[model samples]
Target: MSRSSTGDRGQTEPLAALVAVSVMALGLALYGGYLSDVLPGNSDRHVEGATQDRVWNEIQTNGVFDESTDIETVLVAGSTGSNEATDLPEGYNVYVAVTRVGDDGRTEVVDSHYFASDSSPAGDTPSDGVPDAANNATRPVPVRESPGDVEGGRLVVSVWT
Candidate 1:
């Protein structure tokens, strides 16, 4: 009887240890997934959304589309290589276009600007068309033509890795 009791205790200890190890491993795996934002509702898309918000905020705060501001001049100069400096983030390709819907319901680009990064030739605006990046963020900026005349337009900022 004594020998049997001792043997049972030894087996129980090993079983308990095995269970503890498995639980610890599971906990570590969950933590790692959370850290990497692999869980539901926390993903790379969230980061991309945040990037879009940041770009929109920058455009609004800088008055990029306001006709009264010099941001258009700065962007145009940057795009033309006359001024290499730009307010856009590094490695980002920016396109700004102000379009108007005519009486015939046709949209026309009243004004436009483009900028490309030095390292990315593909970021350059296509000769006959717009930038051809699939992964891009766009924000509609309210264009104030005068003190009270506001129009609707979009500012697109595309980023590539």
Candidate 2:
């Protein structure tokens, strides 16, 4: 009869270790998947409808001064700006615009205020417009046909997340 060596006595250890390693790898993979479900996604989110209404109200109030909405003088000089629009919801972009409505049903953009976006420069505007703002709010307001002439107009405010 031949005697077995000490190394040969533990010959099955490598196979047992291989099985343990496989089980550990599987556990880690399952834990990673579970974390993905529990974590929030890293992408743009859809903004709430009420948020748009709140921003609209703010712009409508901003467009008027002294209980008058004849913003022609303010629009003409291109000096109208505000920090309030930029102080709204976090991770959102804001755009406020004033447009003139003609008797012929045509609309002309008279003024635009942009704020709180990646592309907005110095909290005023991006020049190209508010990025990622798909849904914008519109409301009727009094606009100046001229410096002193009152007429119909529209106020538009857009927000994006």
Candidate 3:
């Protein structure tokens, strides 16, 4: 008899819970599904940059493989080679292409190595990966031909999932 004044108190609890749950479900659906499409995925860019840095580091650790017969691994042993994939991330396909910078400021593909996630081979072009568009990083380096001979080159690393 004393608490009969506000009999709607019990009804408000369930109503409030239903509203809250509906709002949460709607938010989950929107954010989890549609929000990613609206947002530019920076993870791919970050991974591409990181992989580029790793390849450059490996090159520095164990120098670039030249076409000379007396090629040598400069710092680290068995890390960098001409036709092998380095310790890249498992889910990415990487394309490492080296270009010679000529005196006229042009570039020529000197050496290229592909690392595919599926353990397959990439085609003659870069568009053969899972994603046609890519996040790429390029760095200038020196190409060593023989003892006391060096030229300008650039390393281009392209990463795609």
Candidate 4:
């Protein structure tokens, strides 16, 4: 017969392991919550609809697109990046992409591609054609596509998720 040194030593090992594991799991969860906002990655910058509206407002204030025109639209991008995260596929939606044509026969497009999931430590790019701080979430460059047979020109903004 084998003899044990401690009265409850046999049961103590499992209990200790359980407690250790529980603490580790809790710590990991808390870290994950913090990392979600602080992490530097594409998913971190996924913009939402309201932010898009704010960007639109900034555009209106900055005079990016001519609101004086009859047509004005704001593109709300759904995809964050190329991991298949959003409910909608990452592709261009013409309705959201805004374009304007002046009486002088000049065609202009204001591309608001990003629509950030969260507003963490943000960034801003400024230049003649660059988006202002308010519109920083959106991509800077504009991609133009012709709308065949459509009366007005088409503004296309490519998306990936």
Sliding window of 10 residues with minimal summed lDDT for model 4: 119-128
Compared with the true structure, what per-residue lDDT tens digits does model 4 show for residues 14-94? 789999999999999999998887875536334334334444443342323443322222222323434222332223121
Candidate 2 colliding pairs, count: 0
List model 1 lDDT by residue over 1-161, tens digit each.
Answer: 45554555545577899999999999999999777775654655433345455444444534645654443454434454645434454665545445555557787555555555532233234454554543565566677667767777665544543
Least lDDT summed over 10 consecutive residues: which range in candidate 1? 117-126
Question: What's the count of clashing pairs in each model shown?
Answer: 0, 0, 0, 9
Which digits, one per residue and each the tens of the lDDT, describe model 3 over residues 1-161?
46567757657577899999999999999887776666665344457767767766665524653534121132113445444344566677777776886677787776666666642345434565435576687888777767667787787878777
If ranked by TM-score, best first, what sequence of candidates would result?
1, 3, 2, 4
Best by lDDT: 3
State candidate 2's TM-score: 0.43
On TM-score, the candidate that comes out on top is 1
Q: What TM-score, computed on C-alpha atoms, does each candidate reach?
A: 0.53, 0.43, 0.52, 0.30
State the C-alpha lDDT per candidate. Answer: 0.54, 0.56, 0.62, 0.38
Candidates 2 and 4 compared by TM-score, better number? 2
Off by over 4 Å in 2: 1-87, 102-106, 118-128, 131-133, 145-148
Q: In model 3, which range of ten residues has the least summed lDDT?
A: 69-78
Better of 2 and 4 by lDDT: 2
Q: Which ten residues in a row have the lowest lDDT in candidate 2?
A: 70-79
